[model samples]
Target: MSDSSRVAVYLDFDNMVISRYDNLHGNNSWRNDNARDHRPGSGDATDVRLAEAMLDVGAIIDYASSFGTVALNRAYADWSVPANAAYRTQLVDRAVDLVQLFATSGTKNGADIRLSIDAINDLVDHADLTHVVIVGGDSDYIALAQRCRRMGRFVVGIGVTGSTSRALVAACDEFSDYGDLPGVRAVVPTTKVAVKKAAAADAPVETAAAEAGPAKKTAPAKKAARKATAAATKAPTAAEAATALLLRAIRVGMEKSDDEWLHSSSVKSQMQRMDSTFKEKSLGFSSFKAFVESQGDLLELQSKDNGQLMLRLR
Candidate 1:
């Protein structure tokens, strides 16, 4: 968060997209789906889960945040295609500037070229920039990373573990595997009854009752018995774990800050830091905001004047 450690991030979107797509189709990936497939005549639904599973924009940004204040964030891709277009809103939501590159000849090397040029330009223009974080495993970026390091800027590379090029990882001062990054844990789907029961058990009795005041008054004893029965029926589900993680993070953020409310982003980052594999998508939630809103009974969400969401733990 300091000015002295300003960081700039450049993403080769296509490289990441394809890498994740292949990773999903690889062996032993039972949770893998065909969300990132853009084959001809394929009708892929516009689900946030699919896009997120392909390239977790939130995890990437959160990882970048740990290095320093992210002064510049940009992703290069040809957005005209559905593959890249599907992630536009997500990237924007994370405040990442998109640089669209059109495929002119054989392959769209334009994005790579553009990203390198922009990175150099940013380094030259911004004196405070101390780090250049490149998010892609392509060997083509080796030169870019080396150049940044030669110019006295710390270069960090992020890539999918299996798909990343060895040379690309070696070129940077530090390389982070995307899957190993915080907040990217794979979410395994489980029975809804199990999840519901876990949530009931985990829910603070006073808070849940207070939130359910009207229902409580009608049948307090019966409701309490029902909750007990439900908890006894099943153990904590993945959703419950995810919810608890978020609530714990919100509480931590609130305790640390002077303000009572915690930024949704901060809570998410904290949760991931606590467990790198934690991801809302893993809990069957399309997005973080959706997952938070699903727990409306246990938390209060308010939109701040700055257009950011703040969460108040019940």
Candidate 2:
């Protein structure tokens, strides 16, 4: 890829919102709750679970910047809806041009059509744009990806995991799950209380009481719930995550090269490609080498004859 490569990002905002809601809540939960009509910061938009599942727009844009300069970033949505309106501040902060689309019918917001048209037009009009990023998982975008590739432009897709279409993944030059993107924290599953309540609701009254048992039985259940909550809330530390990323990067770099040793710069670049938001400074290291040295047990490092730093998995 050329150093001067330009990228255009087209986001299907509605798709992201609905997909994220369904992923965190139950399937079709967004529609079932009539989330579209809820006032901004009200209803599902402010729900703790939905907030946990919120898409990190800044992270997505940051990852896209890794490829090259993001010259054009546009998001298609019915901004009038509260669900979409909730994201206005973040989108505006990232300088994403919001294209408002009125709902044509109950089910269709015309995002796929509008996004496809704009992406194709941008690709045709700007010869310098070398990368096209489509930020939705609908199979409808298969044709768009095909056309962009045919025009010699690289196509990248980002979508929610279960909600994304497999065909869309095959069509793009690269596909990243939204959850896997850098700076995106994993969504914790539903709470134990919620799960228990749901299960109790389905079971007969006798079974529910039997499962509840006496005070002793209930005491153990409460203790277990507390432990589960603690475990769910305890996220991995920055140093640990960074070390794992470095190890994986080294493994991939070594696999790609015939030599056992991998250059420090190459390994760092691979890490960024895997996670653009990665920075050794964030982990309190002065330099990448310093960070690598901190993981002395997992990595073997040495200076080449020419003073070039190299590393290998220990």
Candidate closest to the true structure, highest lDDT: 2
Tens digits of lDDT, candidate 2, 1-314? 35587889999988988898778777887787676666532222224444555677866776676677788999999888866776766787578899989999986988998899998888888999999999999989999999999999999999997889999999999998887776566666544455466456545665657677741323334444455434434556877768867876665555446898999997897677656679999889999989988988988899989988998888
Each candidate's TM vs. the true structure?
0.56, 0.66
The TM-score of candidate 2 is: 0.66
lDDT (Cα, 0-100) at 303 in candidate 1: 92
Question: Candidate 1: lDDT of 217?
Answer: 24
lDDT by residue for model 1 (212-290), tens: 6643222332344344334323456777768756765665455346888888887787777545689888777898888
The lDDT of model 1 is 0.70
Off by over 4 Å in 1: 1-3, 27-52, 187-314
What are the per-model numbers of colliding residue pairs?
2, 0
Clashes of 2: 0
